[model samples]
Target: MKKEIAAVVFFLKRLIKKAEKLEAEKVDLFVERLTVALQEKFRGHWYTDNPSKGQAFRCIRVNRFHKEDAELLRACVESGVQYTDLGLPKELTLWVDPGQVCCRYGERNLAFTVASFSSDDSDDKEDVTKKVTSAVERVTSDYHSGSSSDEDNGCREPRYITGFSHRPPYQQSLLCHRMAGHVPVFCGDRGDSRRHVVLAQ
Candidate 1:
């Protein structure tokens, strides 16, 4: 089993190179990081039909972890240390999205939501233009009518996110993304259903 996991890791490293070849910029790998250089490796799959890397790593750790690791996990979540707040290099930031760590496990019975989103380079300028225009119009109306708190607090800038996970229907790690350079969001949200499969021999 360990050998099989190792092979999957090795295969993902090669797939990362393939993703790089498809784009010009050096990509961010959100997988396992080296303790030496703080470099992360790709730990996911290549989507042949779509632009994505699927997060489906089998967790041997679940079956063979130190007994105290659970306590550590619980503590980390309680500390409110958001991994997203760790101002990493943008390249590295886009690699993996870890489950929001929490001690209480969430259920997997939620309705699965397959989100249809655009890649950063997707030809969706019209949509963006419409959104921005609508936002401006709303703000303008509110300001004219004196009905918004923004007049006192100032308007908060619209936060623009390039890519977001189309979370799996069942709260599992079965979800994937369509990122530039074909990078995948290789981790589960909330660590719901913990399962992985070998997509290749």
Candidate 2:
């Protein structure tokens, strides 16, 4: 689980480096420092999908408009790096789109949503991963399940995901990107049914 999280962070940092075209040594230094900042202060709110609204992606949201961005910026300043040059935006969101397992971290809010997939009540004993499992089922079923009335109605079903299981998805740590190197902003709003696959906390 730690390896999966690390892989995701590494992938995002690499994209930032390439986009900014930083020197190799500088990339290493900045990424290292930024990683520390993230580990220390990157608070994420995990959200499940809203399939009823035709939304099919699950995401972990970090509102950069809040104090988290400031901590990250302070980390950059201490490391003698400019934050804007890194091209991170006012919001950082990580999403698991349909048919993909790994997360896509982005600079913009996917869109405003009002789906109540989660409970704010304190009596809820389920962990975040349990709450997120149905969404993963929808994702994985997209491959095996044929076209349904849902698709005909212009609604996309959520697809497969990994690293969320009590059973390991793979014996070895394999880094796979569903989309090739492009940081895309998919405009849509989407959840899970059927079998539940719980994610590690």
Candidate 3:
């Protein structure tokens, strides 16, 4: 588990560093590729694709280690934004250590991920699987429509996120859509039944 976590850390560190050195449009493209790599890692695959050349992050900051889902929530609050989770995210891959997602405004793209923020972090295996499934559904829906979020106002803080059950008594079965306020960007898997939207909070 430690080795797996370390590998993800290395990938993200490299991604942020490279992304910071590129131009705006190129940065967006790199972010897209980075999102792809993250989804692969979240889905339990070995993702080694580097989006750009190895450098240092200037504007984008990928939190080296997201220990738990709650920290994601904290990051969102710190950023002064609201984010949502996918209603179904498990069908892709379950990440032991969370990763970052990219949110695009008119010209800027901020990267982040969601995790458990509530104190009731009672995420069993079944619960987490449901969350993953929920995420997939939300992103698919957004993709069919579009990411209509107003990008200019969202803060620059590195966003972190997590999915939870709004239906408290039934936490194990269903996931809730809490990030309804922001624009959702969908990233897909090349060959799998899993996909999700990256919302900026």
Task: Give the number of the best model, judged by lDDT.
Answer: 2
- TM-score (C-alpha, index-matched) for candidate 3: 0.22
Q: After superposition, how far is residue 72 of candidate 1 from its true place, in Å?
A: 12
Q: Which scores better on lDDT, 1 or 3? A: 3
Give lDDT: candidate 3, residue 186: 33
lDDT of each: 0.27, 0.38, 0.33
Ranking by lDDT: 2, 3, 1
In model 1, which regions exceed 4 Å deviation? Answer: 1-44, 48-54, 58-105, 118-120, 123-201
For candidate 1, lDDT tens digit of each residue in 84-144?
A: 2321211110111131101111111111111123333353545534433443343233334
Scored by TM-score, the top model is 2
Candidate 3 lDDT tens digits, 1-201: 223333333333233333244344443343344444334434533333432212122012212122223423343344332323211111112233322222222122232232222223343545434443444344345433433333234565434333322234344222223333444443333244433335545
Please tell me which model should have the higher TM-score, number 1 or number 3. 3
Error of 2 at 38 (Å): 3.2
lDDT: the better of candidates 1 and 2: 2
| Candidate 2 local lDDT, 59-178, one digit each (tens) | 334432332454446556776776666544323444332222243223311232111222334423243333234333332244234332212334344333333334333421222222
